[model samples]
Every structure is written in C-alpha cells, then in structure tokens.
Target: MRHDDDGLIAADALDRVTWAMRRAEWAAQAWKDQRLRPLGLAAAQYTLLINVHSDPGLTGAELARRLNVTPQAVASQVTRLEERGHLERRPHPRHRHVQELHLTDAGREILRDADAVIVEIERQIAEKLGPEKTSQLRALLDEVADAVRAP
Candidate 1:
C-alpha cells in the first residue's frame, strides 16, 4: 500500500481510521515501555499491577474479563508478579476455587512511582495535542470505543 501525506499506509477512509487507532496504541505502548523499563516493569506488567492495585480483590478471571484478555494470560502475569513478591494470591473468602489478588508493599511502591510516569506521559500528550484538543480527543476516543461495544 502507498503511504498518504501523513506517512500512514493509504487505504479507504474507514481502514485509515482503524490504522491510525492501531498505530496510536502501538506508539503509546512503546512510550510506556520506555518509561516503565527503568522501573523494573513492562507496560503489560505495569497494567496488570495497576489493575490489581486498583481493584484489590479481583481474581485472574475477573481481571481477564475487565482487561479483555484471556484468563490464561492474566494467570501468567499473576504468576510472574507472585514470583517477584509484588503480589499475592490469597484464598477467597467466599469461594473455594477463587483466589483474591492483593498487592504487596513492593507492588504498592512501584505503582506509586509508575503513576508519576503516567502523569508525565499524560502531560506530554496534552501539551502536544493542546489542552482543548486533548480533551476533545479523549471524548471522541471514548465515543469510538462505546460505539464499537454497542450491539
């Protein structure tokens, strides 16, 4: 495919929109990786940690559902975090088969530092997009996601 003026591969309008969304996701992940690497986390791992920290007692299955990932994938990340002593799986109070996730002290500390990185990234993006445009972009993106999820 030939590239358009913006250097994105040329396609029909809808395809170009999808391509732009994909590129934006990729670029965001790359930027997150650059910031997270020095903090001893990958972007995916950081996301997992943050989710567990935010939702304190979610099981792997629950997290997978929330993240739109497979349970197996969430389980693997949980295993890695457990091995690193960043998180722990405790017996669920209500169910025999379910285990509740909790962040250890290290996990909390790392997440606190990661939040600073996330804030700085948001600031940079807002500066690049301009405050008004950034807010508009966020609303438009949320609308896009909501539209895709609509039946």
Candidate 2:
C-alpha cells in the first residue's frame, strides 16, 4: 500500500472498496464496544442479545449460524447470559431436545439502554454523512451485501 496526500493508505480501485469496508467494520466494532463497555457488554455479547431481541425464540444452532460461530461458543455464552439473568432458554414447542433463547426482563431493559447508546453512534454517522449520502450509502452497502450473499 502507498500513502496518499494525507499519509493514508492509497489503495487501488478494488482494494480501496474492500479496504474501506473492512476499516469501517473494524472502527464501528471498536466504537460500539467502547460505548457498550460501560454496560458490561462486549460487541459480540450485545450482538447476541440484539439478535435474540429481534427474534424472540432463536435456538443456539440458529444463533451460531447467524453469528458465524461454533455451536459450543454460543452455548457457553448463552449459559453465562442465563446465569446473569439476562437470557433464558425455554423448551422449543414440539421439539424434544431443542431450546430457544429469549431475553429476560432484565435483558429487555439492557437492550433499551444499549439502543440509546447505539442510536447516538448511528446518528453521529448520519450527521456526518448527511441525509443524501447516508441514504445512498445504505443502498450501496445493501447492494454489496446482496452481491456477496448471492450464490
């Protein structure tokens, strides 16, 4: 990589797009972690909570697929959250050996607080990008996501 006028990495066309995406992901994760740290949550943990919050009854296998982690990893984390009273596992309806994750009352409250923190960060992003660019950015990112997900 070469340095541009501001001593930033000067990437070629393709690398520029990929590098920008990766850098944005890393920066967002770090910022989110910092913001969520005071709530005693890591980015990954918050991700788990938010996903379950979005979908009330997701199994660990489903979560592993969504989070792209191994089953054992999710199981351990889910156990910790259950112990913390932030999450609970309920028997899946009509399933002999399956359980679904759901947020506890405590977990819902935590998600509310965390959403305030996250919303601030998002608003900061929108304010910087402005309405038009932010809208365009969302469309572009979605297009890229669709492309990558397509088989």
Candidate 3:
C-alpha cells in the first residue's frame, strides 16, 4: 500500500531537489533578514533597492515585471520607500503616465551598507561550500530557476 505524508502528497512525491531548494531558500532569507534588520531592510525591499540602483529608471510596471510581482505591490513598496526618503520617482521624460525610479542619496548610502552585509553573507556561503561547489550550486540553482520559468 502506498502511503502519503499524512493528508499531504505521498512521501515519494516530495522530490528531494525541490525540498532542498525550498529549505535553502528559507534559511537564506532568514539569514539575510536577520542581518539586514539592523539596516532597516527586508529581503524583498533590499531586492527592490538593488533593482532601482542597477537600472535607475524603471517604472513600477517594469519593476513589477522584473520582480515577478504585481504593479500594486510595487506601487505600495515604492510609496513606502519614497516616504522613507530611500528613493524617488520623477516624471518620465517621454511618458506622461509613467514615472521613472531613482534611488536617493539616502537610498544609495543604505544600499551600500546593506551590500556590505550581503557580501559578507555570500562570502560565508562560499566559504562553507568552497569555490568549486559554490560555482556548481549557483549553476544548478540557475538551471532550476530557468526550468521553472520556462513555459
């Protein structure tokens, strides 16, 4: 007789690769959040800041697409970050209905600090996994992500 995970899918149905990835994600997020807490940044907010910093002119809709989130979600976060003086939106040069995103000086400073923290986190992971394994892990994770994103 085949048994499931007690009202859930069968035990064998929980593929190890997926579970391991999920576990790592949860752990990494918790670790990043804990470290970023002193800097007043959540994982998602830090990600948003990084995106704006990297491109410096993405509209909320564009950001939503990049972040794989809804425009409404991006809007509220943008509003909140703006209120905190972390970022600002200026009217788009060509599009009246769209606003371009930019990080403020404060945003730049905080992002710099947060980046240092994140670098340390990455260094630790690399140290734990060693260089070769770390590279392999990154490639494997990217492949998994690509597979999931592929229609």
Q: Which candidate is the best by lDDT?
A: 3
Kindly list the per-residue Cα lDDT of model 2 for residues 32-144, writing each as its tens digit: 99999999877888889999999999999999999999999999889888898999999999896999999999999988898899999999999999999999999999999
Backbone clash pairs in model 1 (N, Cα, C under 3 Å; residues 3+ apart or in different chains), count: 0
Give lDDT tens digits, candidate 1, residues 5-47: 6646344765687779999999999999999899988888889
Q: Please write out the lDDT profile of model 3 over residues 34-65, one tens digit for every residue.
A: 99999988888899999999999999999999
TM-score of each: 0.88, 0.86, 0.88
Show model 1 residue runs off by greater than 4 Å: 1-15
Which residue pairs clash in candidate 2?
none
Global lDDT of model 1: 0.90
RMSD of 1: 4.5
Worst 10 residues of 1 by lDDT: 2-11
Backbone steric clashes in candidate 2, count? 0
Order the numbered candidates by lDDT, best leading: 3, 2, 1
Error of 3 at 3 (Å): 11
Off by over 4 Å in 3: 1-8, 149-151
Angstrom error at residue 42, model 2: 1.1
